[model samples]
Target: MANLESFIRSAEHGSFSEAGRRMSLTPAAVSRNVAMLERNLGVRLFHRSTRRLTLTEAGEAFRVGIAEKLDGIQAAIAEVATGGGEPAGTLKVSLPPSLGLTYILPLLPGLLARHPGIRPEWHFESRPVDLVAEGYDAAIGGGFELSPGVVARALAPAHIIAVASPGYMAGRVRPADPAGLRSLEGVVMRAPRTGRIRRWTMRDAAGQEMPVLLPESVVVNDPVAMREAALLGLGAAMLAVPDALPALESGQLIRLVPRWYADAGAISLYYASRTLVPRKTRVFVDWVTDAFGKQKLAERFAGSLM
Candidate 1:
């Protein structure tokens, strides 16, 4: 079973180390398992290379045939072994640092109190994770190009609004329109993907899209740092609601243009996709969805500047 599982994980991740980490084994152990499987089958499953593992034709076909059935079999074994189907395992997840800290991180206490059986392994990341290839149980972020065998559940609207510290806006004329923002100092975000300044058009109730650029006063790649810069009265920043919500509520920050915002997309929880969703992952998904509802997050953090 270890040998076969190792083969499948190696095929998926194309790396012995990643598979080993996910399975709680050493890379050498995983390699040995794969070797044993190949010997037993009398065929080479992967073309070994220094950088990555590539599945051969027979390996690909074998993987396709056994993937679904193996999932079912493993799930069944786990269910029987655990007794009463209680979710008790390492729940690996990837989370965006700022947004995860602001919103999702708060729910940990309740989750731990409720399900002490479940152990969480959360990684704070800014890059898009390959869920299957990296063996993550889940990932929560925005603008993910969905990998196959994965799915998304929307948590809240990913809306960005112009915001500034009250001190920063004190001596300045508040912009009546999005175009008026150009004269103000700007704290801008650098895109991690392109390493360029990120820009977006603001949309009004009249459905007009207007391009607006703020004069740069501060620059950063992190949303948390962007929020900090705005709070420190450096300049106005186009901030996503989740990172801006607390400061806005606390009077440290105020929304700049009450009728306009950028519709970035939804902040979604990317789930672990398989034949059957694991019990731990399912409970986690439900817990977050329910908490977001209770807090009326979509309403409080709603993109509409009004």
Candidate 2:
């Protein structure tokens, strides 16, 4: 199984040396493992010339059939083994910058404790990432914005709420209706990945989704920064419930529209096309989904005032 996975990763990487580094094996060891597999199969998988390791016709066909499936099986085995033994291996994941810091980072330690052998390598970026080309095992972010050929699993849904600090609301009259969103100063977010302003969406009385327009006063890309600004009374900002939960509880922030909120949609994890998900990734995904699913963000703080 090691030989098969190593060989397949080497092919995807286009160089045994590169694949060796990713797998943490010596180049010589990688070559030997491939050779053992070739001997067992009685076929030349790679036409290994001095210049480059080229996949033979048979190798190409074999990879097409087994690569992703082999990866998934390997992941499952590792995850299942964690209960009795340490799940030792590197797992790579990609996520949005703000979500990675605020949500995933906090949950990571527990995951590592449960599987002491698993080492997590996280890539947090605002730009759209190519999971397969970048070799990420999985990713977490808003909705199902996965690239073609990827698979996604929804973990939890979050609603967007407009919030400000108590000081900001102390001198101001709160709007009694959703249309009142237009009168307040808005904090605009420039999405680091898409380079677009974070849009606020809400359901009208008729239950039709509509975009809320507010007076833009501050624009930023990072979510944490935006949250901080909102706490300091810069302006009202729309944020995911999970991101705003702590501040709301601490009395550092106050909800603007208590009953009306934007529909932020679900958060999910996306992975490259594989027949079986890697064991570590599956385990983490399961844990995260199970952990966050119990909370209903929209209903929890509907009338919260900090």
Candidate 3:
């Protein structure tokens, strides 16, 4: 069972080193366990190399067959061991770097103070992750395509607003509409997966929508870089609210069209939809929702553009 767990984690991360880090073992130990598993199965599970490690055909099929069952077995054992009391175990989660740091990281200290038994294994991801396939216990972000047995609970509106440094907006006239935004240079973002400049449809409070066609003067794949470029007076940037909110509040970045914003959907907390959710996850979900409501973050995030 330990060998199989090591193999599944190694496969999920594609690196023994990372798997070892997660499992609190050395890379060599993880490698040895995987070797033992392969020997026991009488098949090569991985094609090893100095630069990369890949699962063989038999390994992939084996992982597909046993991964879910292994997880269920682990969960059942954990429930019995803890007696379903104070939830204890490492809770693996995926979160976007910039946004997660801004909004979620600060909430961690409180969560730990309340639930010392729960250990957090948080990974910063710029894109949506496959919760089950990647072995994440939870994921927080927007625009994730729902997979089987996953559910999303929206935390707040993820609004994208055009922003520019005061120096960059100094000499230019404020755009009256999205079309007028073309007069300014834009440090646009390339879609991480598509490798194309992202398009935006700006909407006003009146339910009017307009397509924004900015001349892409500079391109970046990272949201943090996009915000920095705009901060350096390079060009206008369309940034998610959580990414831009700090700067906007500090007068580092100002809204372009205060009345217009893009709706990229809501920043949501996603977890397994199973009825018998782990207590750690249940507590986390409840804590986050309760805190978000008390702080009125949804209203703050939504009313910022207005």
Which of the numbered candidates is closest to the native, going by highest lDDT? 3
What are the per-model C-alpha RMSD values against the true structure? 4.6, 4.5, 4.7
Off by over 4 Å in 1: 1-84
Residues 222-251, candidate 2: write the lDDT tens digits. 777788888888888888777788888888
Please state the error at residue 130 of candidate 2 in Å. Answer: 4.8
Which residue runs of candidate 3 sit more than 4 Å off their true CA positions?
Answer: 1-68, 303-305
Task: Please write out the lDDT profile of model 3 over residues 2-46, one tens digit for every residue.
Answer: 687679779888999988886667999999999999999999999
lDDT of all predictions, in order shown? 0.85, 0.73, 0.86
- Residue 71, model 1: lDDT of 55
Q: Which whole-number lDDT from 0 to 100 does residue 104 have in model 3?
A: 84
Candidate ordering by TM-score (highest first) = 3, 1, 2
Quote model 1's TM-score.
0.79
Per-residue error for 278 in candidate 3, Å, reads: 1.7
Give me candidate 2's TM-score against the actual structure: 0.74
Residue 56 error for model 1, in Å? 16
